[model samples]
Target: MEGFPTVELSGRKQHHCAPLCLLHFGPEGKMMPIAIQVQKCKLRCSAELTELLLRRLSQTPGPDCPIFLPSDSEWDWLLAKTWVRYAEFYSHEAIAHLLETHLIAEAFCLAMLRNLPMCHPLYKLLIPHTRYTVQINSIGRAVLLNEGGLSAKGMSLGVEGFAGVMVRALSELTYDSLYLPNDFVDRGVQDLPGYYYRDDSLAVWNALERYVTEMITYYYPCDAAVEGDPELQSWVQEIFKECLLGRESSGFPTCLRTVPELIRYVTIVIYTCSAKHAAVNTGQMEFTAWMPNFPASMRNPPMQAKGLTTLETFMDTLPDVKTTCITLLVLWTLSREPDDRRPLGHFPDIHFVEEAPRRSIEAFRQRLNQISHAIRQRNKCLPIPYYYLDPVLIENSISI
Candidate 1:
């Protein structure tokens, strides 16, 4: 064996370091540790520099032995696949973390109900937390229904906090029911046994509506105020219209039509913002970033400024964030597909059955652009702050 460049390792003991060396052996020969350079508490070795050293190793000539390195495109493809797996894993971890932390969980639920944007300085701090929250909320709604398993005893999150969790969890269930893959529906029901399975999108939509109705009835019993409140009634109707009965459009996914769904999708994001606030107030979380100088256009406006009177204010700003999130994910998945398209079932006025994957992606992007642009225009009229539509946030989110 010849001399190889060494890399320093920190905060690891010799017993733990032995296995790492064993794991990095090249096909040419076993990696032999020639020297151990110790400085202070750090242990350094040359055996672990596999990527740099392996390429320099002499190849053994044989018909069975082949030497090849992945091309840049191949490396990218591998990385993209890894990124998807990481995202999924991160989502699972986030849900588990929330289940363990009652305060964070409560804050998350509260954020969902309030749906208010935090100031830019605080918003940036919460972005990563919100990302994890959104992913977990989207994928872990079913897991939340296991009350016996996830119950946090001796923790006081208040009645409102509990309600927020229940509502957001139900909202996630609604989203999942509407957008689950056909194979997932089939296999999931079969594996569970005796669970009701929806065979088509329409069936799924109906089931979601029923679930939402039942949840509202059970969680928020029919009181005179609730029943008579026009805003609440209209909000419910809008949720149904956008989530279950919205018309198909070229830019937006047929399943995600309105701002309400977007609001639901980003429930975790809202929770993160609220959670950070709670943490900061209670001395649990701190920010190292300097105070942000928000743009003049983004500065708080006078209360007298005209804005959307109804929930349309929420809807208008929401779609911009929602469209951006959906489009980025759609494009990412599409780019990773073997044919640059994934079959997402048929929609009204669209012949998806015979459409090329490339064409479908193009149409989806076009629809996403249109929705984003429309929301931006609508946001201009609103006096309220719009953190979700922040250009920096959008750019950072898409990259993630």
Candidate 2:
């Protein structure tokens, strides 16, 4: 019930509180949450809150822990769940969505511009995916992450705390998990049932790998060829030194050696710029429309008493009308497709003119089209459709 090592999150100074939710399989084998453990630390009524929380459904989590479950007041349980989701919203918006995809892509795009020639195999293969990323990221820094920006207005973690999240995530992050397949294995979610994101990501990653292999092999036929290319080496080293801060702990390569290595690295960047961004960024509007489902901020502190919650209390905890409007407007604007969008593999800039690479592009487009068709057919049968990673819907860059 009591949090420690207090830090600011909700504008006012307080311990960083986040609920631990426990889930399990239901009667029909459906996965549903069983309990939510709430903590109140460094607040005015800590002892009273703990006393009220002592009477709970489960005690294994620890003494004096406020538990929200099915047996509790329905409004109390729902509000608890919403508060938990609010924490996830900050994590998703700050670290997973903005920092992981957009900011990192901008770094890659800058490295490419500075090191690779216009005709370099990697430059041509990747330039299309970096299109408009610079402009979008610049605007995001100004309007979305500025001191009193949308993040401060709508998020529980004001803009300052939001920036802190990004800094911490960047410091602790490594390159190993960015590789999609390794990420699946590392997280032990490779065989997690009905995880459409994992299933579709692997399919798309394999298809992407094939295309990158074709491009890299057409140019650098052997390991010696990869090691000999100065532009390629410079590009990777700059990314390691400048973007990754020359951290040996990061495991980013200073210089690529083999053709397969180059192919795999290129595939990782393209996947992040295209598919990963689409998965995390595109579904904001539909998921957050029902404010309570994905609340951006909480107006009141979390409930301390077990039987004190009511419908009015739950409604009062939600963000004010102004914050709600701003958050929804931003989500709607971002979810809409840009006018000059290029779907994944739909390159129109003609950066690569060689016959072999042109044919590879054609093949890549056909593969993505096939993936789109399969996803559409599968979505037709789903009770709640999730098609964010459909290659046809994914832009070639983090343009929005």
Candidate 3:
């Protein structure tokens, strides 16, 4: 309100107005709102002044930008969060600057931008940076511990986009660190249920699944290869049994309810088994050798076996959906660039005709024949461009 001072201009011919602070003079020098305000320019200062007031109203603090914990007190604090977030939302240069300058605000902005849709280009940008940091043992440990204060940041990255990163991070930590503490185990397993509820969370799960699935398919031999490690083989079989049994039972939940998890499970199962079969059926070791190139790993033998079974079981549950999705994926994956990007042109435009009380089957059949004859006739006789047909002529000719 102090900044929102009003000014008064009387019956005077003037080009410019006085400073706002001067106009609010009152009795005994106390300030008061001016009865009338004059605009220096014909353009409305009212809108401009209103916007300025709004900006002041929306001012927020800089710290605690990423995590919007409810207890944030100052307006400036929330504002800082939005500012940092939008900056990161807009430009990579802003991210680089923030990282280089240790601008927590910029980092906060970057993390906040992850809340955008998984398909958004911004997700792709931020995901790679996380992967780069996760590869290092020290940074990854910090990430796992949440000491880096990136829980929201981690959650923001899309799952599929971050598949490789997830694999590397989870694998490295699993292998190099002490056994997951009871707390970590408890938190992780509990968090997964919630994670699997959201569609975006499925992306992360899918990536992890892909790695696990591929690993099992490559290593697990189809022809009694379980002889080398009978224990490992037994675990795999058990996992597969449990997964399949759960799916077959009435206890299994609807896919829509646990969509994210189901999607992840499906990807892992399908890809892993498919990869395995590809190797075995082709008599090629390509899939097995290519394992290290993927974004994740299998830390424990039991977990790996279970992951495979889980994937396979999940895949079994969504046969039709899986087939359709895979066909689309394959078409998209195999499509030629530029040409493939063009939409299909072969589809016919359909028009639904409403039934009339007086209409007969014979009349409908006759109309159909007429249309068919017209189409053939036009194809044979009219070699002109499609656009050459006059609208009036078409309307007259097509009239029933």
Say which candidate scores most in TM-score.
2
Least accurate 10 contiguous residues by lDDT in model 3: 391-400
Stretches of candidate 3 off by over 4 Å are: 1-75, 83-400
In the range 159-240, model 2's lDDT, one tens digit per residue, is 7667766776677678887888998888776777778999888888999999999988998989999999999899899888
RMSD each, Å: 27.3, 5.4, 29.5
Clashing pairs in 1: 251-367, 251-368
lDDT of 2: 0.80
Q: How well does candidate 3 match the true structure in TM-score terms?
A: 0.17
- What is the Cα-based lDDT of residue 355 in candidate 2? 93
What is the C-alpha lDDT profile of model 1 across 198-294, one tens digit per residue? Answer: 2222232333233233323332344553445443444344434443333232122223333344333333333223322222122111111111110
**Lowest summed lDDT window (length 10), candidate 1:** 293-302
User: Estimated TM-score per prediction?
Assistant: 0.18, 0.89, 0.17
- For all candidates in order, the CA lDDT equals 0.28, 0.80, 0.26
Residue 272, candidate 3: C-alpha displacement in angstroms: 12
User: What is the descending lDDT order?
Assistant: 2, 1, 3
Please provide, for model 3 over 1-400, each residue's C-alpha lDDT reduced to its tens digit, 9 standing for 90 to 100. Answer: 1121111112111111111111234355433333221112222366775575456443222332122222433332222222222222212211221111112212222332434344432232123222212222244234422422222122112222123233322222211111112323544443432221122223223333443333333434243442344333333243333322323332222221222333333333232222211111221122222222111111111111111334343222221332233323322322212221211111022121323311322342344344434444554654432211111111100000
